[model samples]
Each structure stands twice: as structure tokens, then as C-alpha cells.
Target: MNNAWTDFLARQGTLPARTAEGATVAVPLTQLGLIRSRGEDSAPFLHNLLSNDINKLAADAAELNSFNTPKGRMLASLLIWREADGHLLALSADILPALLKKLSMYVLRSKVKLSDASAELALAGVAGPRTAELLAAAGLPVPAAPRRHAPAGEGRVIRLGDETFIVALPPDALPAAFEALAAAGAQPAGTDAWMLATIRAGLPLVTAATQEAFVAQMLNYELIGGVSFQKGCYPGQEIVARTQYLGKVKKRMFRVHIDAAEAPAPGADLYAPAFEEQSVGQLVNVAAAPQGGFEALAVLRTSSREAGKVHVGAPDGPALRFLDLPYALP
Candidate 1:
């Protein structure tokens, strides 16, 4: 366990496990890890590799991006931010080592230096309707919109969505910062609660199980600003662009609720009667809903989603009902 996290939980007591409308939860994001790319060539090096236009990333901004295979399958989805001296990419910790190695392979003559910065930096999720107010009361500058960040004491505060923000700071500063946040009305909740919020927000994270499963569009990456259509070629640029311009995207990620006893794991296949024995969709992420059962994001063939009922595990398994996503699908 992280010492700062342990200390925070010890001081704040156990927070309410359920997600409520006006409550603010302090979530320990231990499952996610960070990678730092530093040097004069950092921007161009990443620009040549990721789906988004990294070259245009502003100093105070962050963006959703992806690393894809040459065939246009997504290998990893990332939340990239700019720092004073480097760039930070946050993704599933389970894939961090392999992703770090994969990214290093393309360095060639670039001056960029990649390192796992997870140990050096401590991250926490602060979310709810009171998120901005609580952070502002703690003397942190609150970002006004998604993808924007502001300095907060010795760390930084990044807005992930309307009422969601991430706090990134040095390990030494975590305890005091968290203490202030708790005192300012942020409840201490487990990471599962945070993941639930992420799913409800329609954010899809790439995990080890789902690596190289779909192209950017199939996951609605472009709809959510994860892809830059105007940017120059990267590894899977041709395929991504072709899908955007010439080919029609048949599969897309959707928000849905499953009335199952257990939350389905990422990459679990979803079945529809129309598809018979073949899988028509795959789970991207799932979290126990505060209301009941489970909520998840899945990428499914458009025809299947429209023509037949979806189920978890098999055709006769627990049924899944589609929920409206925060944004519209193109």
C-alpha cells in the first residue's frame, strides 16, 4: 500500500462507497501509472507516435491519445499532459512496462528520454459536484474545463471532465494535500468508486486484455477527441484515416447497464442473437454501479446493437440495456 494513501485513509475514515450526486470522493488511483518523456525532441517524437496532435498541445492543457499498431488496432489509450520540463502519459499500470519498452523501440535518433515516473509522483482522483469548490477552497487553482490543468501547491490539478479532476504531486507532499482536501469536504473512497465515475463519464481505458483489439474509431476515439484527423501520418494513420474518409466504421463503443451479479472483466465477449456463436462485441471496461448491478462500456457492431438484444457471457446470459453516452456518436 502507498504510505500517503494509507495515511490519508487513516485520517479521513472510510468514505461512502456509493456514488451520490453532490458528494466529493478522494480516490486512490493506484491502478494507473505514469510515464515521462523529456528532452527537446519530446513533442515531435510523441507526435510521430500517438493518434492526437501532440505538437499543438499547450503548456496548460492535456489530451486523450492513443498508440496503435500499424494495422490501426489500438495498443494503448493515454491521457497526455505537458509539464514544465517533460510530458506525462497516464495509462493502466499493468501495461506500463511493456508500453514503455514499445515506446522506446521507436526512439531511433530522437533525443527523448522515457522513464516510469509512477513511483516519484502520487496521484489521486477528486470528483463530484463539489469538486471545483473543494479544490479552490484548498488553495488550488481549478481548471474550468476538461483537458485543462492548473498549478496547485507543489503539484498540479487536471480537469478530466465537468466535475472530475486529478491531483498529481510529489509523494512527500501527498499527505498534507490530501488532509486539506478531506477537511475541505472531499470524502475518502476506494479506487473502485473512481472507476465507476470514469465509466459513467464514458471514458474508455486500454487494458492488457483489450490491447490491439480495435482501431481508434471503433472505440469512438475520434468522437471524444482522442484522434487527430488533420495530423500527419503515424503508425496506423493510413488505416485510421481510411476508416474516417473512405471506409464506414461498423463497430463503436457504447455505454450500457448490465443486470448481472458480478461485474464483467475487460475484453469479455458480448453476444447477440443475430451473431449466433460469434461475438459481436467486447467489453471495454466495467464497474459496479452505485445504484445497482454494473455499468460498462463496450464496443459492438452497430448492426448487432440495433438488431438484437445484448448479453454478457452468452446469448442466454444477463441482458444489457444501452445507456445514453455523454456525447453523440457520429
Candidate 2:
């Protein structure tokens, strides 16, 4: 843990608490980790390995991407951005070591070097109607739109969506940044609040348990700008393209609400009456809803989502009610 960042959080008192009306919040994103890919071959090497067209990535933009097995199953989901020297990939910390090793193996003779950047940087999420104002007061340059990024003091601010921005900076610079944000009326929040907002926005995260469980399309990765059908071959390009053109996609991710006491884990099986003993879906990610209960994103068969009654764990488990995603399914 970063002592500076941790101390700043401690000084802020207990978080994940609701703030008064009109107040904003900054949540620490401890679960996320960063991977830096540098050297001359960074762009093309990554372009040939990941699902998105890294060759087209601009220094001021960020994009969602995925790494898949040859069998076309998604192994990891990534948020990629470019910097002056190299590229940065943000993903779940639990899978970072393995992913780094896996990516290194493909380097061969390429001029690419990959390493974990978690220790060098810290990430925090700020949201609420006043986020832009707070960031401006902190001397940070806020991105003008979603997926766009602007330079901050030796770091960057990425606008994830409406009223939501991610602040990435050196660990040593975090305390001052947090202080500035807090002074500007931003409340401190726990990571769960940020995650809850992510689910509501219909973003998908691939956790350890869910690795290789679905293809990019099954998680609606392409629908949300995570895939590029026009890009040249990657590991699973052939299968991904075939699925898209052949119209064989049977499962899709959906946003839903579950009135349960405990939050369901990612990769938990979801059953429907029509599927009998078989699971018709799997939980992708979930978080406690501000309105009570849980809000989650699950990948389920289209048939099950349309007609069958869905349950959390088993056939008789707590029921899941469908919720509209921020974007329409293709």
C-alpha cells in the first residue's frame, strides 16, 4: 500500500458513506492495477496481441480492450491509454502477475518491455454532479468527454462517463491531490461506490474466476467499443469474426437488480427454470446498490433473459429483475 495515499484516506475518516445532497466523492481504486508496456515495438506488438486496434490509440484517448485465448474465450479485460513513453493498461490486480507473464512470453525478439506500474502510480475515482468543478479547483485538467484524457500534474485525468472521472498520479503526489479535491467539497468514498457506479454504467470486468469463461461478444465487449471487427488478426480474431458474421451469438450481458442480503460473487452461476439443472448465465460483476440490495451485470443466454425466470445461485435462489443498460444491445 502507498503510505501517502493511505494516510490521506485515513485522514478523510470512514468512507463509503452517503454524503449530503450536492456533494461529490473521491473513491480509492485499490482493486485496480496498472501494466506498462514500453519500448519501440509497444504499439504494434500490443496491436497484434489484444482485441482493439492499439495502433490507432492516441495519447489523449483511452479505450476498452480484451485479451483472449485462441479458443476465443476472454482471459482479461483492459482499459488502455497512451503516454509519451509507452502505454498503460489498467486491470484487476488479482490477475496482473499472470497477465504480465503471459504477455511477456509473446514478446520474443520484439522491442517491448512489460512491468507492473502499481507501485509507481495511484488511481482514485471521483463522481457526482460537482466532480468537474472539484477537479478544476484542484488544478486538474478534466477531459471534455467520455474516454478522453487530459494531463494533470505529472499524471492524467480520464473521464469515464457523465460526472465520473479517474485521477491517475504518482503515489507521492496523491496526498496533495486528495487534499485539493477534499477541500473543494469532495467526500471520500470506498471502492465499492465506484464499482457500483461502474455496473450501473454497464461496464464489464473480467475477474480471476471468470477468466476464459466467455468470448468477447458474450460479454458484449464489442457492443461497448472493446472490440474492433476491422482490426487484423489477434489470437481469437478468426473466431470472433466468425461469431459476428455468422450471427451465432447466443449469450449476452445484461444489467439486473437482485434483492439479496449478500452480494453475489463474480462467476457465480445463474439458473433459470427453462435451463433446469444447467446454468443459463454467470455473474460478471456486482456491487451494493445505493437504493438497497445489489446491482449487477450478468451474461445470460438471450432466451433466458427474455423468457425464463432467473435466480442468483440455484434454481430456487433469489430472483433477478432485469434492468435497462445504459446502452442498447446490438
Candidate 3:
């Protein structure tokens, strides 16, 4: 990361207040780190390792993919997109260093080369009602649909949703680009708000604390296009495929509202009445809601979710209020 860009964001004051509905804000996504893969073997190398089908990735699009353990547990969840030279992956920053090292261990004779690109590239999230207008005014391409990316100034403009866009550009270009959008009525939203938007969108972000705690299906990877049933064998592919084909996926991630006084952290145990003393769920991602509680994602037994209330932290702790996910689940 660039110290200049980091310094500029440090002066942006406190975290912006936001709700599940989101706001018209421009945010520096400091939580995510970028990784670059360039070489003839980049696609094939990644195709053999990740949950998503890399072979089918389109030039103008991005896909939710994961690096999983041999047991089908996720080590890292990434948003993979294309670039002129090769591919770029955006994942939780806390896990990037270790993930990069682990991936390198597998690059025996592969032509692909991986490097941390966070210093050179920066990610700025433009969200809310004015997202499109602000992008166009900033001289960025406004993608027509979600999951599609378009080349812009020095990086790429990715449209995540109707009200959300992420611009990945050169670190040197971020300050100017951000200023132009803010001048056009985009509030300087901090990572807190950006995180809320992600939780509400039902996008599961696997962080360091929650790594390998659940399988790909438990996080609803399959439901949200993070997994490809048709893709060839990856680490733990057999278990993942068996879970799918045998119809044995019982636990799935769900969105919820927790009215606790303090915010919950990832990997926190959840309980349900029917499950008794057993932990029926675990918090996956959490962000403070603009309201007096937290908006979060949790992986829970489908049976527990339907039985009754699920509480966070303890069996008798604060109850979690369920929320609707942007997409439907089967």
C-alpha cells in the first residue's frame, strides 16, 4: 500500500455511519489486498487450484473463487478479475501474505508468477444511489451489469451491483480519482460502511480468524457462484463434489441482525434451542449497523435456522434477528 494514499485516507475523519441499505459513498478498501498472476500458465495453474472454473473466466468479467484445503475448507476467498497482462485477485489483506507464500509452494514448473500488487494498485469502492453518475463523471467506465469489469484510466472499474462499483486503479491515480467523485456528491465512506454493504449483499468474506472453519458449501459458496460443479479436481474437490451430488449440505450461511451491545467477531459460536449445548452456527462476517446493532453473516444448520431463534456468543446470549439475502437460496 502507498503511504501517500494511506495518509490521505487517515485524514477522512471517523468511520461513516451506514445501514444495510447502504449510502452514496466513496471508500478506500483498505481491508482487501491485491495479487497479480502473469504468465502463460496463470489460468491453468489457478484453474487447478480454485473452486471456480478459471478456464471459463471471461475477459470482461470477474468471479468469486476460493483456495481451499484438502478437506474442502477455504483458506482464502478471492474476487478474480482480468487485466491486459494477466489476472488480478482481491482478497482479505490479513491472509494475503500467507496465501501468497502457500501458493508459491505449488508453482514448481508453472510459468505463472505471483506478486503482491497492493503497493502499485489501490481499490476504491463507489457505492449508493449515485454510484453510476459519480463513476461516469470521474472518467470511469460504468459497467452495465454486476460481475462485469471494464478498463478505465489506470486500472479497472468493476460494477458489483446497481448501486455499487469498485475502481481498482494505480495508487498514484487514486487520490485524484477519489477527489473527483467526492466533489460530485460522493461522501467519504470508510471501510465500515463498505463492509455493511458486503454483508447485506450476502457476500461471504473469509478472513484469517475464520479460515478453514467451514467448508465451501457452509459459506454458501455454491449459492453465490464461488464454486463450479463442472470444474475439474482441486484440493478437496472430492468432498465438495460429494457434498453437492449427495445432497448432504446441511449448513448454509445466512444474513442476520444482532442487537448486542458489543459487536461480534468472526468464528464466534452460535447456539439454537434445538441444538442444546452444541454450537449450531458460527459468525462468518460482521459489521456494525448504522442502527444500534450489527449486520452479519453466519453459517448455521438449516434445521436450526428454521427451528427458532439463534443466539450469538452463547446459548443464552443475545438472539440474532434474521435478515433477507439479496439472492435466493435453494
Candidate 4:
């Protein structure tokens, strides 16, 4: 463990104690342009619009799901947290504006108010086991086991032990929180670390180029508990359910280990030996590997993935080797 944070994480058993400095960053969610949902019909309204069962998400619990167009295209991938009065939708900082505009069109008669709250809150993340202890030591409320999240000091926090929590901190309080956490020994890892951690954790994030490119199944949402086929209709539920029962999922998300120092941009087209002209898949996220090179998550045709020869950054970019994902596909 090179950094104090890494040393603390080693104590908690999160692998690869120290990888890089700037591993974490406190970004403003509202400033990132996230949309908010508040009002009496918020849950039901969202329930009807997204891929997952919004009603099933218990208070303080967080879930990963997507908002898809009627044509089975994922418009935005979100990490949602149910607050006391409404729901907080956390999305990629890059896609916040477009996400807001896309989801806003459906707000018609619904009582929900969709506005960007990213500016009002701070978003922070960590990677490694020591993250839990760091949270506890910082006097922040840590999520009770793995895959749990809670409101800590007016922020929505999720426990991604291999990665840090995606905490929604109050804007004005962010500087103080960052100072405190740094003083307590948390290094500021960049998005690279968090993205790689997410890929390793089997977490998929959606972006512009890949929007509406995949259904929940294609993204392996079922495998990660992001979808409930039994849950009643959400937007495109018919297609989502049919794909599971009647249709075989030809495409799905895959984790790959590549020996490249440069991280590919999200939504970058992925070419495979099987696919000649059309792209076989798209990159969801990438991160620096613990040992060396890089690791990333991508959605691709299962057949192509199984056949191997995955490459990115070129028609003949660096070749990628498949890695076992932390989770199993359905």
C-alpha cells in the first residue's frame, strides 16, 4: 500500500491497495446536468418509463437501470436512489444534458418535475475494500454490506467496494468533505480507476453513441439484478420480456482485459473479426488494470465475443483478451 488510503484499503482486503493517484474525484452531479424526479407520481411515473422496476427499489437502496426509447434503444443508463420525497437519478457527467432533454419529453401529464440536480450535489468515488473503512472513519454513513447504499450527510452513497461510493454530496459542503476525506487518507483517483472498477464489477454505463443500442439483456442487466422480468410493464417492457422468453439474446455485455495503456473512449465502436462492415459492439467504460495495461466493459454480439479477436481504437486497434466478469450472465 503506497498511499494511506491504499494502506487502509489493504486492511479491509480490497485488492491492489494502491494503483494510481487521482483515483477519486468529487464532481458536481447537478453541474453534470442530471435530471431530478419529485412529486406524488414520481415513482409510478418513473416505473412506467424505465427498464427496471422502480417500485421494487426500497428506500435508501440504489439500483442500476436504463431509460430506453420505444425501439429498444437505451437512452440513458442511471444509478437511481430513492430519497424521502423523490428519486435522484445519477448519470454519466458527460450525458447529463442530453439525458435531461431525452427524459423530459415523457414528463407530459405526470406530476414529476425533471430538472438537472447535478449542480446541487457532488459526486465522488473510490476503489478498493478500504473504502468502507474510510467512509466509517470519515463519520460518513457506510452502506451496510456490499451492493447497498444510504444517504450520508445529505448525499446519496453507494458501496462499490472495489470502487469507491458514488456519493451525492451537497455542493457547498463538498470542499470540506473532500478535505476531510483526503486528510483521512483517501487518494483522488481519476475516472479511469472508477470506470475500470465498474467494468470489473460488471457495471455497465450508457452514453451517446450507444444510446438505444441495447436492451437490458444485451447489457446483461438481468445478471446484475438491474431488471425484473416478472415486474410489470416499463417502457419497452414487451420487447425486454419477449427477448428473455421467446428471443435468444444474440448480444450481451462482456469484460475484456487488454494490454494497452490508453483507455478507449466510452461508446467507441468495437470491431471483431466476425463483423466486417458493421460494428459488433461498443465500449461502455475502461479503467487501468491493477497489474498493467487496461480493462474495460463492452456490449457485443455474444457470438463474436465467444469467437474472440476483440479490438478497439482502430479498425485494427489493440486486441483485447476476455476476462471473467465478477458476475454470471443469465
Candidate 5:
């Protein structure tokens, strides 16, 4: 078995368990996460910095956005919400610290308070055909809109019909929820399994390596609804909007198959013959592919991407076979 598969099986039963080829991982997040937001400054503060329109987020709703630099490179990808007390921001576990630090620096005078909520929440990914049934069994109401979250604070809830959600539960309440779900036939999964679902979903995660590297659009943020062009200005909003409206994108994220024994680490360099020693792109994330070899997501320069032969390193590096993503590029 490949490392990805092995890792998946090993993490099975934990929140976000690893699963078989294309299987989804469901994790319990109660004690594993935390949730925090600004009471008054939550919405406005987030609106000013995020690539999406915060004002548009309805109560009991969720919005996808990116925290990008002035150059349009994304610092973090976020799932923001309008909770009872304030707004919530959900990001990959790895980028939370950096995100909090950056947001804090920007809050200089703003009334927003940022906290790592991963500790208090139960974050899980539910992939596979049975996700909806499992969620419904758990009492999580199905979301009417795809990629949306609804109000499920006090009781069990479901959303998007099939997609599992990350829930913030008091530490004491998690065991009971997990037990209930387990009794309902929901299996426990690990982080890697969740990662597979994320890849299948075509969701791009921000890691330390790819931080401040590509603009939100370069990663297909708009196609995934991570960018809101009509929203007011935020950091790098101009560049993101212009690129989309003018079709001036020079680089883009892609899914590829690697017939190698090694899994490429995030932020690894990618090269092409046309670029010689100069790098044409960087690896965003990688996992052992179920079909064979390795599969990964990468952001490549437009010119180099057109060449088709993308290498994981210098010219002598292993070859990468391009794979079709679940979504279309703009």
C-alpha cells in the first residue's frame, strides 16, 4: 500500500479519518477546536481584509474568502460566518497561527479579537456517497445551498446534504456526539482522509511553503467562490478583480499525477523545459494517489503550464502527469 493509503488507514476512526480511494474522512471536532470572533468588529473588520463580501453573509450562513497580500498572493483561505456573538473564521489547522498573527497586526485599532478555535471545535470531512445520510442521521440539517453552513449550535445538524461540517462543541459534549454518530453508522476518519476529500473537492489549502506565493485567482479562488469581485476593496482586491475581468492570469493551480515513490512536500519547486533552471511553479499539496503513484496540487506559470511536461524539481526531476480537476478554470 502507498504512504497515503497507509496514513489514511492509520488515522481512521479519528475525526477526519483516512479512507479508501476517493473516500471521505469524518472527524469529531468538539474538544479538538475552538471558535472566536469579534462582537462588533467581526463583520466589518473581516470585510475590509477578506476577498469576499462580508456584508453578504446572512445569519446562519457561511462565506468563503481569502486573506491576501498587497500583491494579491493569498495568506490564508477562510470560511467566515455570522455566529450569534460575532463572526467566525475557519482555516486549515496549519495556517491558523500565522493567520491570527497577521490579523492581529491589522487590528491595531480595530475591535476584533482572533483566536484559534480548532481546539474547541470538532472538525471533520465527510466524503463518499453516504455523507448525506450520515449527517442526516446525526441531526445536522442538510444545507439548501452547496458549500454553505447553517445554524446548528445547540443540537446536532447537517449541511449541504452530504458534506460533513466542522462543529464547535464543548469538550464535555464531544464524546456523546461522537458516540451518537458512531451508533448511526458514521465511521471515524483521520486528517489525511479529510485531505483526500479536500483534493477531490478541489479546495486549495494555504501552507507555510505556499504562503504569499500565488494570488487567490491563480489558485482558482473565484471559480470556487473564494473571491467576490463585486465586494468592496480588501487587500489585493484590485489585482484579483482585474485579473479576472481582464483575463490576465499568468499562473494557475493544477492537479497532477506523479508516478514516483516519493510524495512531494508542500511548497516544493516545479520546473519545465521551457523555463530551464528557472522554476515555473510550486507544489501546493501532495498525497499518495489511490490509482497509482502520487497525486498533488500545484500552481504553475501559464507559459510553462502550456508546455505540458512539468517536473517536480529541476529538468532531471520526476515527471508529473496532469489530471483534470473537479471544477473548470475561468
Candidate 6:
């Protein structure tokens, strides 16, 4: 969303070509949408709608949450954290406008102001073993560990997980900020580099085509700290509760590798011949793997997954080789 940084990346020819191992890489996270919520009742307003417990959010910690439809289908996945004014919610830009409009409808009498800050703010995705050291040198209060954040003047530094960190600051400060980081031995990359790291991190955000197509569990939200079973009622609480209480999650998202000529789109149908023409799953997130072929996260039927035979487009399309997810499943 930072036009200037986008121009910088274009003119600099830093479009991420490969996520080389152990290299410090930085990219403008233009694919994400930033929503700023400020008001006396901002917390309560969002607590009543999101899948996680907003009341328990801490000033220095981030929470992964989802905006679900009443029927328990996920519409958007959010990485929420506190800011000086209120809260900052980062999500996929493709679904932001529609999701923001739908969320505003419930504001009826709340003293909440939800503004799209994507255009006003700049996001930088930095990943590498030296991320913390480089960021601290850039005057950012580099977070101590994953899921933690620290304030830095008008900007904020968050360590998403492991070596991956995101910095949110005013658009005008992006060029200087990234210049400092890159000078500190960081490689400037494209958005694709960041997207690949996110996939390996086992995080999924609802895109337009996949909206309302999968529940929180199907995305492995519970296992990844995106849901709170003890939290009070929110939209789709009952259905989410029922799914949790049920015997087991029959469908789930998994990390897989497909050696195809081209990567498939999100929400594309997946098939297992055992199902015989019945779609067994849908692709959730996809990116071209740096190591050739494409790596993706897809929701698959437990039975199909157990059968160990799933393909894309059709039963005979590209065969997907199962891969390990960063986190363990229940």
C-alpha cells in the first residue's frame, strides 16, 4: 500500500527472485491491509465480532484472529495488536474493503471509528537470522520474541514468528527505514519472498475467492493460536464450539508441494480419485516455492488426506506431495 516503497522496489529491481537460505531479506508487505480502530469502545466493538478474545489482548503482544460469518465460515484472518491510538489489524488486502464495510454495519451505537489505514501506513517484511540486530540498529524497538511487539515513536516492530518481523510506520518513513535495514546487510526482496515465508509459518488468511468457504478449524486456527475456546460469545461461537466439541476435525489445511507448470489459484478444487469426481478439498493459499514447483496450503478431507492421494484441478491433474506443517495437529 505504500506507493513510494512500491516504486522503490520497482526501480531498484529487488523483486524477490529466491529466498536464499540464511540471507537477510526485506520487502514491503503491500499485500496486507491495515485497519486502525480508535474510540472509547474499540476493544468491546471488536471483541463482540472476532473469533478470539480481544479483552485479553496485551499492549506488547499480538493475537491472531478471524472474522467469521454467522454460519462459522471465515471471511478474513487478522493479526491484531495494540497501538497508541487503538488497535492495528493487518489482513489480506484483497478482502479488506468488503470485510471492513461488513464489519462497520455492526457499529450501530458503538463509539468506534474504523478507518482503512493501508494507504497511510507502510509495512515491511524482514526475515533472516540477523533481523533483530539489524532492526534494533534502525531505532526500532525490536520485539524480544515471536508474537511480541514494541513501540518505536510513530512506528511499531513486531516479530511474527522465528526470524520473520513486520514493521509498520508512516509511508514517508519507509524509504529511509528500509534503506537503513538494507544497508545493515539485508537483501531487498519482492512480496513473493514474504508470502513464501508465511506459508511455511502455517498461517492462512481468507482471500476473496475462499471467503466463507472454510471454518476456523479447517484452517488449523485453533492449533495456531487463532481461536479461544474459553472466550465469551462472538459471531459463529456456537458452530465453532460444536466443531471443537465434536469427535475430530474431518477437514484441515496442510502444507503440500505440487510440481506443476503453474501454481493454482486460491479456492481451486482439489480431488482424490477415491472420492470419484467429488471435490475433496480447496486450495487456501498458494505461492511459487523458491526451490522450484509450488508450495500451497489446502483444506483436505481427513479421509482423502489419510488416503495419501490428492490432485489439483481434477483427479488426474498435478499430484501433490504431502509436506510437514510447522505446527503439529491434534
Writing each residue's lDDT as its tens digit, candidate 2 over 1-330 gives 576877776776767633444447788888899999999999999999999999999879999999999988999999999988789999998999999999999999999899999988899989888888999998888899899999887888998888889899998897788778988888887777777778878888898989999999998888889999988999988889899999678999999999998888889999988888799989999887776788889999999988958998889998999999989997
lDDT of 5 at 57: 81
lDDT of 1 by residue, 1-330 (tens): 356655665775655556665568888777899999999999999999999999999999999999999999999999999988779999999899999999999988999899999877889898888898888887777998899999877678999999889999877787777778889998877776787788778889999999999999988989888999999999999999999999999999999988887778889998988777789889998877777888889999999888759888887888889998988887
Off by over 4 Å in 6: none
lDDT for every model?
A: 0.87, 0.88, 0.87, 0.71, 0.68, 0.86
Candidate 3 runs further than 4 Å off: 17-22
Which stretch of 10 consecutive residues in model 4 shows the poorest summed lDDT?
A: 24-33
Supply candidate 6's per-residue lDDT for 120: 79
C-alpha lDDT of candidate 2 relative to the true structure: 0.88
Clash count list over all predictions: 0, 0, 0, 23, 29, 1
Instruction: Tell me each candidate's RMSD, in Å, in order.
Output: 1.8, 1.7, 1.5, 6.2, 5.0, 1.5
Backbone clashes counted, model 3: 0
TM-score of each: 0.95, 0.95, 0.96, 0.85, 0.85, 0.96
Window of ten residues with lowest summed lDDT in model 6: 13-22
Question: How accurate locally is residue 11 in candidate 6, as Cα lDDT from 0 to 100?
Answer: 74
What does candidate 3's lDDT look like per residue over 139-249, in tens digits?
789988889999887789988766878899887788889999988878887787787778878888899989998888898888888999987999979888999888677
Q: Is candidate 2 or candidate 5 better by lDDT?
A: 2
Q: Considering every candidate listed, which one attains the maximal lDDT?
A: 2
Candidate 4 residues lying further than 4 Å off, grouped into runs, are: 1-33, 160-163, 276-278, 313-315
Per-residue lDDT for 85-145 in model 6, tens only?
6788999899899988988898899998999999778899998788888887776777887
